[model samples]
Target: MSDNKKLSYCFDVDGANFTSAGEASVKVKKRLREAGFDPETIRRVSIAMYEGEINMVIHAGGGKAEVVIEEDRIVIILTDEGPGIADIDQAMQEGFSTAPDNIRSLGFGAGMGLPNMKRYTDEMVIDSRLGKGTKITMTVYV
Candidate 1:
């Protein structure tokens, strides 16, 4: 079913700031909570979005994230103009990471970002082109 209702928010991810990662997701989560969404739903959406935000910062050198909240579901779209994913299959696998060692030192690059985002969301779509960019859209039912 298509949702006629939609809520959209835009955020900028900072690639150079590791500590600033997930800030967007945190804001989204707070808004969702204040809107009276259940804790479980809030957690799921926040976690998935947070991971996507982190990926954009690390692999894509930042990006734009759009969140659409409908009556029955929430849709998150993350777009980046950095290096694209070479192998989506491999990247989707848990424990596989292409992040640099420096990134690993920051507590990321565990290779679970994509996998975790998929696991938490009901639907996930990835559109990527080498040397061009990547777009990830994920959805979760309320």
Candidate 2:
């Protein structure tokens, strides 16, 4: 392949299935490895992406994710058209989750997703509007 330092991948998040929630992140991990990222960097990127992916599937019904690999960092952008987060601060808390009971029953919605995402990424930004949607951008240095 061409030696461009920039690479991108897009994925359509599916809400119909929880088992496949992390598919996009998994693919990203592999791609990052093929692109010669170190194991720690790959792990950090994958963890952040996977958490964002799971959140989208759980709360947004569905969404879209884009992963961009640049010379200095990996950027993950996740957007959804579902109900937006009401309180970003609360959502960012480690023990606060608004997921439905059904979702909680699945052993997820532990309220750690957002916090973990932020912890694993070098930078994270969330733009959301009540009743509109949410767009999360996260970056991890390589």
TM-score of each: 0.95, 0.95
Q: Which stretches of candidate 2 lie over 4 Å from their true place?
A: 1-4
TM-score of 2: 0.95
- Write candidate 1's Cα lDDT for 1-142 as tens digits: 2466667889999988889898999999998998788999999999999999999888888999998888889999999998999999999999999999998998899999999999999999999999999999999999
lDDT of 2 by residue, 1-142 (tens): 3498678899999988899999999999998889888999999999998989899899999899999888888999999998999989999998899988998998888999999999999999999998999999999886
Scored by Cα lDDT, where does model 2 land?
0.92
lDDT of each: 0.92, 0.92
What's the CA RMSD for each of the models? 2.4, 1.3
What candidate 1 gets wrong by more than 4 Å, as runs, is 1-4
**Model 1 residue 25 lDDT score:** 96
Clashing residue pairs for model 1: none
Q: Which residue pairs show backbone clashes in model 2? A: none
